[model samples]
Target: MVPMRTIAHCDLLPDLIQQLLESNSDTHLIVCATRPEFLLHLTAAIRSQRADPDTAASHDLLTKTIGLLARSSKIRLAFCPTLESLRAYLAVLGANSNESTEEIRSRDRQLLSILDMVAMHVTTSEFSAQGLSRTLASAVEAAYSAGMDLRLYECTNALDPSSAVWGRKLWDMSVPSLNGSVRMRGDESTWGGRGVTVKRVAERWFEFDHSH
Candidate 1:
């Protein structure tokens, strides 16, 4: 029997996994602050491999990535944004019907579990965001509590009727900023009503801003 040697590359994945899992409040603050850049990285990574067939190596990579995300302190803070990314990846898989159904289903189950955990955290925690405004406000509060100073700016176009309706409701709830400057035009007006403009769901962004 020969002794097994650990190479640097062999340790890389595990090290990354540990770091992500052991992420602290400070880590969450950083994630909240640089969410856009983080998301862009995630998107590019996904797009780069979108055409690759699901293999054992690919599955392992995804599993490790998801595990890291699950254990990260930023999990709750970045839940929605992360979910959107996951949804995009899953959409790619879904579009490729050639893949094994069993494999796809298994991956879907795992993703759904992660999503459920996020929803549960939001529901159980004292940190709550009612609508877009409250959501941004809570994010800022969370970041500040974590001792991070960051600013976020968001511009959303509510083209979908469903999204516009919900956006309007969120606006009324005071969770979203209705500064009365952002306006909806053209076919978008049919979403809520004729001449009933939509407001910017988020003027100030960031899962958590430093200012309370």
Candidate 2:
């Protein structure tokens, strides 16, 4: 199986891109970001590096890489918003004193726009039932509108009442797999059932699918 490589930081992107271009066309890549503004940060990083004469060539390469990644059929342009990441962002934003509210809001808007433009699969995250449902449903609707596939989700094992409902809903939607579950921290009761399937993809990365 082809391993799904994650870009946890912007600095790691260039090397990952090179590997993808040089390796088999079936490489799966995901931007595992806790912040919604990760793409903006990535762009900023690229621009800052491009200003330096030494790294200018890399900037051009990164641009080309982004283009290829966007259009490649063999590559998956997936984004994992990360479990509770959205909520954490909200909390941090509320407390952050460095930026004004309007500035932050504008930045967030840009992040969402960038995400819509580049992401093929976006994993939903959050612990609240309402938040989980909203994010998952919104991502699904967005993917459908963009003619993309909804195949990834952040993992959870202990399904509180609400999470269980969300999981059942996902099963009903026929989503093929989830992104993380191997490191699930609580009861496993809700995850095991007659028709459910769990497969380990990597450390902390598990797939939960239902029998169709």
Candidate 3:
């Protein structure tokens, strides 16, 4: 039997790309969140290592990899300028793709409509902040309606103790009802300042608290 294939988020490590090339001769590879410079470097490295006398086989591999990404349902690749944009795109894509192709396409159109509305509001420079927030809220609502999990990460002003306190408070308030858990990083003084410490909060009052 053929081994089950896997798809990984390639944004984290370039070495992952090399590993995929070595291990998965027939497996489809989809790369996302790659900068143009990185892509060029990868292409150059692959070309330099080509063993084929005519280099046609190596070129074919490159073409095939790109083609797989373009038409893959199991793999959705996207590049966004900001992490927020990436998160937003993932939320929409995840929600839409849980259904039939036609349904997914319809959801895509609706998402685009929401984006257009937000863009128009921004252009007018009238209540731009409110408009942007509304746009994000609309997108999140659509995601939730489609049964996708959407989460917004909290920003930390590391220099301010008050900011950290508020951040922890907000997390504490929000995490209790979630199916997943939340954590806080402990001070280095607790463990003799040797390594990182993480404190896991319980999702349910009945559950035990743990630390690592």
TM-scores vs. true structure, each candidate: 0.26, 0.31, 0.28
lDDT per residue for candidate 3 within 25-117, as digits (tens), equals 322222222467336545554554353455545444445577444433432234443435544764665466557645634442221111112
Please identify model 2 stretches exceeding 4 Å from their true place: 1-10, 34-36, 58-60, 63-71, 84-212
lDDT of 2 by residue, 1-212 (tens): 12222212122234334444544344334444534455554455456557777786754455576656554555555444654443343334334436554553443221111121112122332222333344444434433333223344322112132443222233332222333323234843232222232212111321333321
lDDT of 2: 0.35
RMSD (Å) per prediction: 18.4, 15.7, 14.6
Compared with the true structure, model 1 gives a TM-score of: 0.26
Question: Which candidate achieves the best TM-score against the true structure?
Answer: 2
Instruction: State the lDDT at 145 in candidate 3.
Output: 49
Model 1 — which ten-residue stretch has the worst lDDT?
Answer: 2-11
Ten-residue segment with the worst summed lDDT in candidate 3? 197-206
Pairs that clash in candidate 2: none
**Candidate 1 lDDT by residue in tens digits, 6-110:** 101111222222433453323321122135644554444444344466532454444557655555644334333443343343344334445454453443221
List residue ranges in candidate 3 displaced over 4 A: 1-35, 51-76, 98-212
